[model samples]
Target: MEMVYANRMTMQTIKSSTQDQNPPTSPGDQHSDSGVVKDTMAKRSTLSETVNQLQTNYSSLKAERDELLTNYSSLKAERDELLTNYSSLKAERDELLRQLGSKVEICEDLFALQIFISMFHNFWIGLTDSNEEGTWKWVNGTTLTT
Candidate 1:
């Protein structure tokens, strides 16, 4: 039986005892005083039971609260660690992008130099003449075309 139901039943019994009171109590009627004493003892026992249940409930709740605190702290630490790792990875990605951009600039410079070399070589070929027909050659005796 639930504690609340048991308590209510006990309360009803006490009320009945009170309602059946004797109108005039003679000193010889030791029964009336004994009845009152028994009712009081029953109330005290019920109250004691209620108090013990409340204490037990409190202890259970307190332990649950401690477990929640432990879980919260662990989760907080994990979140911090994840944030740190994310920030570091972001920084590393930015660094890699910066390096790639620098390399692209260097490659562009080298490409421009190669284009200039080809243009100068063409100019020299234009300025020079073919010693014989159908033979295109450079000043360095390298054959320019077939």
Candidate 2:
């Protein structure tokens, strides 16, 4: 019957496939296969160690980046605070100068004074306005006329 023939053919095919999976090998082939397996295992171990080392390095770098970012934020905050304080001091100085009605005077006299002070440590000035602003006076308390 056809059923009996089909069953016989299936059994033969199964046996053939099984033989292919576990074919008889020479001693040489066995030794070569063993060597290939050992080599593959060694390569796998090296690759695994490399991957672990890379992961550790990546973690350290990430931590360093985070620390640097934190420091940058702190520095930025300090700079902003300093700027705010500087602005406040500048405003206060302007207000005080305004209240005193004393404006900063820039003229050749200032430059001359700087040169004279650099040249000498202690000296009496020939002309000054210490008694009153814009009213030049001599050290003998005599007012200078233009």
TM-scores for all candidates: the values are: 0.48, 0.50
Residue-level lDDT of model 2, residues 36-114, one tens digit each, is 8878999999999999999999999999999999999999999999999999998998899899764443334768779
Report the CA-based lDDT of candidate 2 relative to the real structure: 0.80
Tens-digit lDDT track of model 1 for 1-146? 65544588898887877855555465545565776887899999999999999999999999999999999999999999999999999788778979865221122255775776765543222324468676766556667663
What is the C-alpha local distance difference test score of candidate 1?
0.72
Per-structure clash totals for the candidates: 0, 0
At residue 13, candidate 1 shows an lDDT of: 87
RMSD in Å for all candidates = 23.0, 13.9
Candidate 1: C-alpha RMSD after superposition: 23.0
**Number of the predicted model whose TM-score against the real structure is largest:** 2
